[model samples]
Target: MSRPNLRVNAPLLGARRSGPARLLAAAGLAAAAGLALPGPVAQADTASVRCSVPDLVEAIGRANGTPGADTIRLAPKCTYTLVTADPGSPANGLPAITGDLTIDGNGATITRPASAPAFRILFVAETGDLTLNRTTVSGGRATDCPLFPGEGVCGGGIYNLGRLTVNRSRVVHNSAVTTVDNLFAEGGGIDSDGTAATVNDSEISHNTAAYSGSTPSSAEGGGLANDGPLTLNRSRLTDNTVSVADNTDSFAFGAGHAAFALTTIEHSTISGNRVRAVGGTALAALATGSPLPGQATSLSMTDSTVSGNTTSAPNGVAVGGGLGTNFPVTLTRTRVVDNTATAPGGTARGGGIHIGRTGDLTLKDSTVRHNTAHAPGGTARGGGMSSATGGTVRTDRSHIRKNTAEAPDGGTAQGGGVFNAVGSTTLTRSSITDNRAVEGGGIFKESGTVTLNDTTVRGNRGNNCAPPGSVPGCTG
Candidate 1:
């Protein structure tokens, strides 16, 4: 896991096996059987990559040509630059994984040349299984492609439609950009569709997503755009961005987009992620599901810290500088600090959390502080959180302080702390203090039922809220 300070490089979880041991494991097996497997002694042959294979592409072909559950044990500390003559249907480029396979990179780096065609480093086809061990994938660039029926291009670093797991790996400095109108760009580092890509002891950082298209399309998920299930443990996502574009109908999302997916993150850190759209979210787990009673989507974050993230729709509506979800979201033992959601010419809301779907949002033992929602030409509300109709907002043993919601150009600004509009809100054993807004500085109730128990509502900048003995603590 990354340290609280962002300057250090966290190492992998466990030590890697030595090269000598791996090189000799196959030799020992062959000698014990009184049979000789003639190949170079530098790499093991427990799987498919032969010692005589010239390059990575051939090795991939050889491995794919073989049957199920193969492992391509690569030479130690090698760098394979994948290239292709025809990238669309490439004879080169990492072959699409056909079945279950493990690439024992042994600390290798698989990348592409600078002058190569815009291509991703890896693609996991449907029903294929890929496990990357101790490797690095970088320098990928995905341009406008017809992958989304002339509507979008995604997964600059990795496009996965299957199962992908990584152990002790890093995916960095990749990008996905689209210039075609009516098309969108997603997943500067990775885009997973129906792909349960799990990462352990890994880092995905420094990726970018730039899309300048028309309305009704989003340029989102600077680090990862997941349309399925994604889980992370002991990982970091930092320094990623979704650049501003002409998107008006849809908003951009950064860090990770659980737009139509389920995400679980634990012991992880998301920092320094940025987005600039007409009105979008930054560094949030966005759940865009209106399910049928039993098909709800959600995000769960435990023991995580989300800091130094910015989301702005400078000319549109901006919500959720830290998190935006339409379904159930739970934040336990989490800290969301120093984040901003700005809408300079439009509406801005929810500097920390935006609950849109009609579900319950629970925050336990969490801290939401030092966040801001600013609007220069429009209204601003909910420096800490905003819950729409049908959603139930609950906070227990939490602290929400030092937040600001302001409209600089004579626009209305209310709900500096919390905004409960047509919802049910409950605060138990929580602290709300030092929040500043134009009207309600502690909690705002447009039309809702609020219940407070053992909660502290004090030190707010405006005396807009009622005394502690009331539910839905504020009245405008």
Candidate 2:
């Protein structure tokens, strides 16, 4: 959506002035010294190629072979639509990047028409480092990528094996599908494997990754899949989804869209993202992953908002509607609210947050409220949080309130606010209030070490503690 009159930002202007713009600004000074400079004097000389409207596929093909980290400047106010002339050829969409490249959209858009085959708009190879500025990558569907034919499709918009940088741009409405049933799909918008991706001041929204058939399907990172490091700064990820088939042992991750590696998010908003599976053995939504058996996967958020993200499998156990991790998660000044996990045929746990087996969760100055977990046929546990065995949860100066855990089939509902099972739970100056459940409305402590120092439990619908003696100031 950053079209003509995109309003040059200070960072973009500053980048130009410092890098290649020096060739012009300093030209006057060089001319005074009677020195003639040929071109950009950067480590790898910069090349700028202007794109033609309907021939962007060829333009991208040419840019892929550029000598160095060059720039491709598109024509102002143009939307390049790519179509396939040959349906059988694997070389259909834009060519894969073979070298370092930077695309300056200049208010243009890159998209493939619906008539084209299911091809991604981009492929950043291992040797290709891409920096996209002021553009949009939309409506790409990677159904069959010839490079790795047997593997399930990935990176509907872009597959990055090298470094990727997106600034002042948008990646939306893309999809990654399994050409053949039962395969895995990942990163409907972008997939970064063993690399570093930095997306700032942009929007990645409305993307999906899915599969069908009686066989199993696995989906990760609906808007993005990161098996490497990923950073989102001042960006927004909204309304993305991953739909996996039922009756499989599957994991649907990152409705707001992130995963598997160290992820750092600052001043961003991830809302209205979802993962809905038909019926799987176990389904973890929002974000799902575990570190090496002994190692830990980390998700760190600062001053961000994670709200309205959901996890639901029609006939499977649903966990972590807002977020889930098998390792450790650190949230500072973040808001987690209004997330839900409802299992029509199975049980639901942790409508807001779920700490997997062998996981650790921490929240500092954060708020988790107004979440719900429902089990229509089975048991519902932990409306706000559920920590499994060997898992620990810690909250410092945070609030967990007004969450609900329900089991409509006359099952069991425990811990509308929090549940600790064979895990250590600690609260320092936090409040758990107004939670509703069948047993231990405020907290269900079943064989865990619970220590509440300067914490409050009041106005819960049922008992405050499961055993009535595990927590101080709580009586059944």
Top of the candidates by lDDT = 2
Q: How many residue pairs clash (N, CA or C atoms closer than 3 angstroms) in each of the candidate models, in the order given? A: 2, 2
lDDT of 1 by residue, 1-476 (tens): 10111012100000011112222343464467576455443332355443332466666666666655667887777777666532333422577776677898788887777788777778776657888998888877775332343456778788776788988888888888876765667788887764477988888889887777554445667887766678889888888888645545454665544344567889998888877766533324332333224554677889998887877777677777777666677999999888887888787778877766455689999999988888887888888887744578888999999888889878877778887778788889998888988777887767677777888878787754633334454343
Alpha-carbon lDDT of model 2: 0.73
Question: For all the candidates, what are their Cα RMSDs to the real structure?
Answer: 11.0, 10.9
Each model's lDDT: 0.69, 0.73
Least well predicted 10-residue stretch by lDDT in candidate 1: 9-18
* Shift of residue 160 alpha carbon in model 2, Å: 0.3
For model 1, the superposed segments whose C-alpha errors exceed 4 Å read 1-54, 85-88, 143-149, 279-293, 388-390, 464-476
